[model samples]
Target: MKAVVVEAFGPADQLAVVERPDPEPRHGQVVIAVEAAGVGLVDILQRRGEFGFSEPGFIPGVEVAGRVQKVGEGVDRGLIGQRVFAQGSGGYAEQFVADAAGLVALPDPLSARNAVALGVNALVAHFSLRRAQVRPGEHVLVRGASGGIGLLAVKMALQLGATVTAVTRSTAADRLAELGIQNIVRRDRETEPAGPFDAVIDPVGGAAVPALLGRLAPNGRYVLNGGAAGFPPPEFGMALVQTFFNSLTFSTFSLNSVPAGEAGAAARAIFADAVRGALVPVVGPVFRLTEAAKAHLALEGGDAFGKIVLEP
Candidate 1:
């Protein structure tokens, strides 16, 4: 099997397409013949040795869509040949193993390619919105509104009957409009409309967090899921103290940390939403599996409006 192996991390050039042994499923796990893999910022970070997963020779992908080739002991035999998507480590390869508890059967209506596009982005959006307890008729503002997670956050908020205000750079205005996002605001002028929003979904933290805090309504929730702007070491003590005094809620989420017992159920719910058209997977570009370097470069370029995928 061919896999993108990172023996050392520094830049995209460090990744090499090399022959590697196919993964063999262990107990409670299944090996997937990978069809498509989701490319995300975390993959880029891992490639650069920033995510701190393990040391060397790591395969960075976290989410993948493929067909089950083999099921290990203690796994159901009926799962063989099933089409599924799973979230785990070492997904950027032609074959990988995933825990049965972490796998979700793909719906007939969703293609393998599209399922990978949904990846962790949609799940994060679902988790973020649920944790925020966003209600119908609430006003929701999504910072980084054109990003992989941000775009899904916008869609899910709208689906829940919230009026969404999507904040992105000026250049993405037309794209947001095409997605039926009417209340689009440029990031440079994000605070101009003056919101006392019921909830704010902020993935691009830094100075933007304080601005988001200022826009929140009383008792409003702010969910921070990512730091697309680069996680500058924040002054959390004083800022958290201020949040406590303001009677507001601040929370952070990582889909990777979702427990095994609940991961499958949550992923199934998200997949159902996608099948029903309540959530759409936005695919930006597709690259061959061997083109991992190019994929990383494109993700770092910062101009992409949707998810990038790698086909195996």
Candidate 2:
């Protein structure tokens, strides 16, 4: 098997492809012949040493889609050859070992690439909106709306019947419009969108926090799901104080807080929606598995419009 290993986190070049012996599944685990792996901002951050979750010699990817090649004890033999997607360690490889219980079977209509693109991203968007308590007939703002999770958040918010205003660079406005998003706010613009929104789904936390919070309407909810740009500036706290009289609600969310059974059910529902074409998968740059460095560079460049995936 070929796998990408983080020899030492610094630059994208640190990711090196090397040959390794194939892995066998342990008890309650299965080996997947990885078809595709999803790449995100976290991968970039981890590679740059900004997120120190893993040490040297670690395989960096987390989400993958493929077919079950083999199963260990306590796993169903019938599962072999079933298409599935899962979130686990060492996904940046041609083959990955994952707990059989964590695998979510992919419907026939969803391709492995699309499944990898939508898996964790859909979970993030779905749970973030739930945390924000987004409802119909309200205006919602989704910052960093051009990235994978951000794009999914925009679509899910629109489906919830909220008037979604996507905040991204001007380059993405036309594409977002094609997705039925009419109210697009350009982050690069000199003028900002006046929101007073019912809720704000922000996946990019940075200096923009204070201004976006100011746009929230009285009693509006704000949920911070990811910090792609880094932590909120010191003024973030002051921004909340300034909006004190608005009686606003602010919270942070992670899939870790949700029970496994509940999240699995939600993921299945999301997959069904994708199968029916209610939720479309947006795949951006596709790179070969061995070109992991190039994929990381593309994501760090921030020019790609959707989920960047690596095909093995």
Candidate 3:
């Protein structure tokens, strides 16, 4: 099997394509012949040794679309040859093993490419929106609205009947407008129609934090998910104190941190939404598996409008 292996964490350039042993299924596990994998900022961070989770020499990918090749003892053999998508690390290879509990059968109408897009970004958006408990007719603001997670957040918020205001530095206002989001704000001018919004979904935190808080209505929920703007992580104690003082709700979310039991249900709901066309998967670019370095570079370059995927 060929894989994108990080020999050491330094930069995207450190990622290399090389032959590696094909993974085999173990107890309660299944081996997938990976067809496609999603690439994102976290992969870049992992390559650069910035991500806090794992160490070096690991295959770095979190979401994949593939077909089951083998199922271990205690796992249903009927899953073999079934198309599926899963969320977890080590998906950047031609073959990888995964816990059977983490796999979801792919809908017949959903292509592998589209499934890759929905894998991480869409699921996170679904979880975040559910956590916010957004109500119809409520005004919701999404920071980094043009990025992978942000774009899905915009679509989901609109689908839930909330009025969405998207914040982006890109000039893709027309694209977002076509998706029924007319309230687009340029990054330079965030103060224009001041909001006492019901909820604010912020992926870019830094100065945007205080600005988002200012726009939130009393008792509004602020969900912090990512920091696309490259800001340092906030001081949680201080932020919590401020939230308490203002009588507001502040919560942080990471799909990587979600418990195993809850994650499956969330992924299922998100996939159903995508299959029903309530959520559209925006695929940016497709690279061959050997081009993993280029994929990571593209993700870190901040020019893509949607998820970048690697075809294995």
Candidate 4:
């Protein structure tokens, strides 16, 4: 087996692909022969020693889509050779162990590559939308709308019949337009979208928070998910004060903070949307497993247009 190891967790070079012995399944576990792995900015932040609790020398992928090669005790033998998406550690390799209970069975219409692209990203989008109780005809605002999770939020918002305005870079204008996003605000060239937005899905936290908060419609909700913007806005005090009179809701969410069943349902919904053609996971650049360093840099530099996948 081979794994992309975060050797010392400092720079791009610190992330290297190295040969390792294959892992065997333990009780209630399954070993997946990883077909493709999703590359996310959180992975980059982990490589940079800025995200999660992982230390150096850990393999750095959070989600993978592939075939089950072996099953452990109490696991069904029939699951062997099945195509599935499973949440697991060490996904940046050819093989990794996943608990059988957490696996999402992939449908025939969804390819392994697309499953990896959509897996965690879509799960987050689905959960976020559900949390916001988004209504049809609501005005929705999606921050970082060009990134992997952001793109999915856009798709889900559109599917919900919300009028969505995407906040992204001017470079992403054409791609956003191609996706049927008519209104866009570039982070560099323009001001944030002035909403009266009924729901604001902000995965990009930071100096933008207060501005986005101010634009929210009275009684509107802003759900903060990720902080890819690095630094957060120093307006928590004001955000608290304004919420009182505006009757607004400024909330935050994490899939990890939820119960196992709720999280699993979200993951299952991601694939179901793909199978029904309601959403298409946008896959950006593909990298060989060995090219994890380049993949990390591309994602961190905002060069990856959609979910980037690394194939082993």
Model 4 per-residue lDDT tens digits across residues 140-215: 9999999988889999989999999999998987899998899888888987777789899988888778777777
Report residue 312 deviation for candidate 2 (angstroms): 0.8
RMSD of 2: 1.2
Taking the tens digit of each residue's C-alpha lDDT, what string does model 3 give over 191-303?
54488789988777765576567667877898888876666345544554665656778788888788876877777777788888877888887899999988877777766
Spell out the clash pairs found in candidate 3. none
TM-score of 3: 0.92
lDDT of 1 by residue, 81-168 (tens): 9999988888889998899877889998998888977768888888999999999999999988888899999999998999999888
lDDT string for model 2 (1-312, tens) is 999988897989999999989999999999999999999877777777777565788888888999999999999999999999988878899999999888898999999999977988889999999988899999999988999999999999999999998889888888998888998988788466787899999888887788888888999999999998888887677777887899888788777688767878888999999999999999999999999999998888878888999998
Better of 1 and 2 by lDDT: 2
**RMSD score of candidate 1 (Å):** 1.8
Task: Tell me how candidate 1 scores on lDDT.
Answer: 0.85
Top-down TM-score ranking: 2, 4, 1, 3
Best by TM-score: 2
Whole-model lDDT per candidate: 0.85, 0.89, 0.83, 0.86
lDDT of 1 at 213: 75
**Best candidate according to lDDT:** 2
Residue 147, candidate 4: alpha-carbon lDDT: 90
C-alpha lDDT of residue 195 in model 1? 90
Task: Work out the TM-score per prediction.
Answer: 0.94, 0.97, 0.92, 0.96
Task: Indicate the residue-level lDDT of 156 in model 4.
Answer: 93
The regions of model 2 sitting more than 4 angstroms off are 52-54
